[model samples]
Target: MKNLLFTVFTVAALFSACTNDADVKTFVNANGYTIYNDSLISFQKMIIEDGKVRQVGGEELSEMGEVIDVQGKTILPGLIDAHAHVMGLGFQELNINVAGIETLEATLDSIKAYAEANPELEWIQGRGWNQTLWPENEFPTAADLDKVVPDRPVWLTRVDGHAGWGNTKAMEMANISQDTPDPQGGKVIRDRTGKATGVFIDAAESYVTQHIPAPTAEERRLALEKALEKMASEGITSVHDAGIPAQTWELYKKFADEGNMITRIYAMIGGTGNDFDELSKNGPIKSYANDRLALRSVKISADGALGSRGAAMKEPYSDDPGNRGLLFYEQDELNEMVDKSVSNGYQTNIHAIGDRANDVVLNAFEQAIDEFGDQGLRHRIEHAQIVSLEDIPRFKELDLIASMQATHATSDMNMAEDRVGSERIKGGYAWQKFLDQGTVIANGSDFPVEHVNPFFGLYSSVTRQDHEGNPPNGWYPEERLSREETLRSFTLDAAFAAHQEDVLGSLEPGKWADFIIIDRDFFEVPAIEIWQTKVLETWVAGDKVYGNSD
Candidate 1:
């Protein structure tokens, strides 16, 4: 019966029978929940007018335009993903994705099927192959791929996006050989006899990937649309696109100008290459197209990921002795980049996954702040995955945000401790430690790297466990976040990270009418069942953007 009522509203929205944006519409009988004044509040009635919340209360308010009862549905502020790759997620959907394949044999079969299905694709391109998940837990070889995809060149990126697996055809096309020197901050895996193993890590991926044809403008538009639709359906109304190349920024602008954006995007321009030089010169764009788009942040990659043993650690890996991880840039180079970004009035967000990388990023950020005085720009460290215990408090002291992906902890639990060992592991994905030091964490899923569903992140944050409930006591149970903390991290706190807290984040009177009606109350659901919660309707700026009617 509740679903029927929800469907009715959705259908009405589709035909323009719903209240117009200019009119004051009262939504009644809703179990509304939102974070306000650092507390979760409940409201039964709310009024929305001109794409903003007008009033919210426990009792019915005076009706001004139209009254619609949501029939006792659960409503909450729209989830915000603070660290996602928008274009990458879109491409993952469009290409051959083997994200969840349990074994190498199955993964190969899946790849073979995809190649056979897409016969027109000259180069078979895909991502989301995790070598660690295979039974043998070994990186795949060119021979392994050649058996399945012999004719066409094939390149598959690891799930972390820090490594790439190329078939013999692809490597041959790039003219890779045993003598091919490793690029700075990157490596080409080699066998015992110094022969290329067809695996490229970090910067070396560019050699093989440069040959693939770039997507046309129309293709990019389609991919963006697909990503927006997916975000809407999952109840996400806003996304902090972690990094945007110049081409993606142009596409996002087109969508915003046309008012075609389904989810609000807070984009961070890539802080390197010709795009950075071009975009940053004009300064930051605080807001555009009715707050549907904002480009005021710069994203810099300081190091690689932990999955591929590429994260820059202070000490050598526990599993692989005598070898620490890689840092993408030297200290002086990173300091200059951060200083340039903050000086230009941009919120700088750097990706630092290992202890050494984190240390370097913190130093860079501190130097930038000292030179420019922070200026109220909330600099962030994306994936503060591994940190020295001594450096953890520096986050709070410097007023920097830890833009973390909760699911990364759950996903990396199997190997994180193995890589860093027991003692250093204490500061790995240390949510409680950050919170204890008064550091704010902006949570996300790093979608396509993990799953796109925000609920997956919420569950992981609160439970500190895998979907199947591994380690029953939770992996590092001490680091688990409370339900309220997790919700705030994804909603209000995330908005704060993007500097959109003034106009977004909550159901307050002056906030944007961006919220969602879900099937279950997130606050009341059992911790283990949080991931099962589904979105019944998603509203952005008081308009239904996605619903079950679709």
Candidate 2:
């Protein structure tokens, strides 16, 4: 009887041990199961539990629970746009959109139609008209616009955002004429007989633009929403919005508070006297509101763009003799703003295109660094195009980010060489040189100036060609970046420039689940095929924000 009791007790103990083991195994598997299987070049499978990744590898995933099969798709971290005029793009869409209008007739017709539809509006506002793409590359005269909207004043911008084309009524309203001296860093295109031609470049645009009415608060909110939706659909999860106004910053906060902000925005308040004084009194915002909106930078325009021949060059343009480009701000004023931004713990992003403008910006940044020491402040030079060879190394020496638009090189390739000449072309868009010197480049599209899609950027960076693949061997092929380097510029390097690398820009574990699934694997496909790739879906923080059925 005692032996029988011993056998029963032993059996009971074994059963208890088995039950405890099963309970422990269930808890671990339920809580600890997070995996990312990247076995295919075009797809990746992520397994998550309680919002964090447990593992990421390229192998079987039979053990993973609730498997997300992202098969036959290329997975990459959600793209970051290092430089963009988001508010400007949004506002332009709400007003008149003449982006693709080819001829002068088409531009006038669009304006006439807009005027008829919005009769209640005080001033007619529009943007996006490029004379460069037209049959006649010369600037349009007021007569072209005057024929359509003789009664209504109209203000239209060139595609480069550096020039404006206004009607006769608008020009008259601004009191602009042949005798009106051109603004320091701008131009008023004139006829052969010295009459104003209605085309104004750079600072000259402000002459007519300042007269246009500002959008209402509600209208501004709607524009911001529209911009965010478009950005998410194109695989952009974050943007460094350049030149945001104080009122716009308030609207951004409201949207963020209501959880309506789809894309993370690092806003650079426009550096005006009032803005600087306000910022100085209150101090920089310094990565606030859960890192969704950071107001820690200021944007200053030191020069204009190359398309309008307004970028400040060291020497006169080879094609346009007796004319050097414009500088938007004086050197002394630029230096003061740089010092103020650095002292107040704000990053300074200055727009510099031509060699002379780039030199001035570099000098200011160097001085600021010397005064403040390196606070890990990643100050930036926006559109570092046409940089001098001597100034290229300054980017690395001062730990500055080159926030460049890859498509700029491809788009400008046809005319850039003529503007700077063959001797100076070597220093133009020198991406490879900056990379070799251990500097990080943040890639962007400068949208409304170029396409918002990142593939255009990727294609241009790797091939140095437009969508159709021009120049056979690629334009300035030496400046072309490797496939991996180009991808990094848009991804990891871009994130680092925004000071948000820890959360986004990579698919590693412990990072936010922000990524995109594309139709083609960039690594395995031909360079030309990259531009043709399509984004299938985009996710932000494990939530699918954009997806296409077809």
Off by over 4 Å in 2: 1-43, 48-54, 60-66, 100-102, 112-121, 280-282
Off by over 4 Å in 1: 1-22
Candidate 1 pairs with clashing backbones: none
Lowest lDDT 10-mer window, candidate 1?
3-12
lDDT of 1 by residue, 115-170 (tens): 99999999999999998888898899989999899999999999989999999999
Cα RMSD (angstroms) for every candidate in the order listed: 4.8, 9.8
Error of 1 at 143 (Å): 0.9
List, in order, the clash count of every candidate structure. Answer: 0, 1
Q: How accurate locally, in lDDT, is each candidate? A: 0.89, 0.77
Deviation of model 2 at 338, angstroms: 0.4
